[model samples]
Target: MDKPKVAADSPAQVELEEGKKYAYCTCGLSETQPFCDGKHMSTDFRPHVFTAEKTETCYFCRCKQTGDAPRCDGSHKKLQEPERKG
Candidate 1:
């Protein structure tokens, strides 16, 4: 069986500012995964806005092909990030 193709972002592990609107990347081409990196300029990609009601961690979708918005949706489960252990 072939493995499912996932996007390029993990879940949001950090906290967000209260009452702040964030533009998430639906397209996986963004250099800034989970966020809009202006890579969608060429395509019809649009920035997703999610207002933070309070400061808390939230998962944004990095896979431009995800049906879910502002969530990982297990798209990046197989993908690994560069080792940046401190």
Candidate 2:
């Protein structure tokens, strides 16, 4: 059996700015990842709200398979790690 794959266009992404609020995407269908692109019209998913207090970047969950919604749970690392060398 093949491992399940997550869509490339998953609703994952996050921006950080001092005292700034952003609307994140959680439907994995948004044209804009981590942002509410109004693509949740056809799905039952809703946009998520996030705030920042510093100029930083955050990893949003693009797989939608994370137990921690709207955040990455090292899932990307699994896909990005290099194969072990002997």
Candidate 3:
């Protein structure tokens, strides 16, 4: 099993439909970004299957470091990257 890859350092804003089934990519390997495109099949990662509670714009976690799966808990804001000396 491989650790999840960071798709981005920010959350992805997406529009979700109420009662709609969605597949959120836990593995950042997906070229589809926040959504699953079956890229996790090569790894131990799997999509976070969920249904939309309400039709609204939502921020989805892309960093894959959120304690809350598929939700942006502002975890990306806490990622520590090496400071560039340039």
Candidate 4:
């Protein structure tokens, strides 16, 4: 499949409930930003299905480039850095 679209150049802080299932957007095409909204249906990508371990605010990756699936690893920070001159 092709590379995912960049939903945003930052993480989405969302409140997750313990024991609740969440479908995080992997394709970066969801209108829901960090959550899945069935936009991946046209692509090979599927939502990252996971259950919240605890009730708390969590940072979810919106750039779709995090090494840690469905979570932010500060990858978005690097993505927005100004390009170096040659």
TM-score of each prediction: 0.65, 0.64, 0.89, 0.88
What is the TM-score (0 to 1) of candidate 3? 0.89
Q: How large an RMSD does model 3 have?
A: 3.3
As a whole number from 0 to 100, the lDDT of residue 60 in candidate 1 is: 66
TM-score of 1: 0.65
lDDT of 3 at 36: 99
Could you tally the backbone clashes for each prediction? 1, 0, 0, 0
Name the candidate, 1 or 3, with the larger lDDT value.
3
Descending-TM-score candidate ranking: 3, 4, 1, 2
Candidate achieving the largest lDDT: 4
Q: Which wins on lDDT, candidate 3 or candidate 4? A: 4
What RMSD, rounded to one decimal, does every model reach? 6.2, 7.0, 3.3, 4.2
Model 4, 1-86: lDDT tens per residue?
Answer: 59888888878899999999999999988989899999899999999999999999989988888999888998776764542111
lDDT tens readout by residue for model 3, 1-86: 46788888888899999999999999888888799999899898889999999999988988888898888998887776841111
Error of 4 at 85 (Å): 21
Candidate 1 regions exceeding 4 Å error are 1-9, 75-86
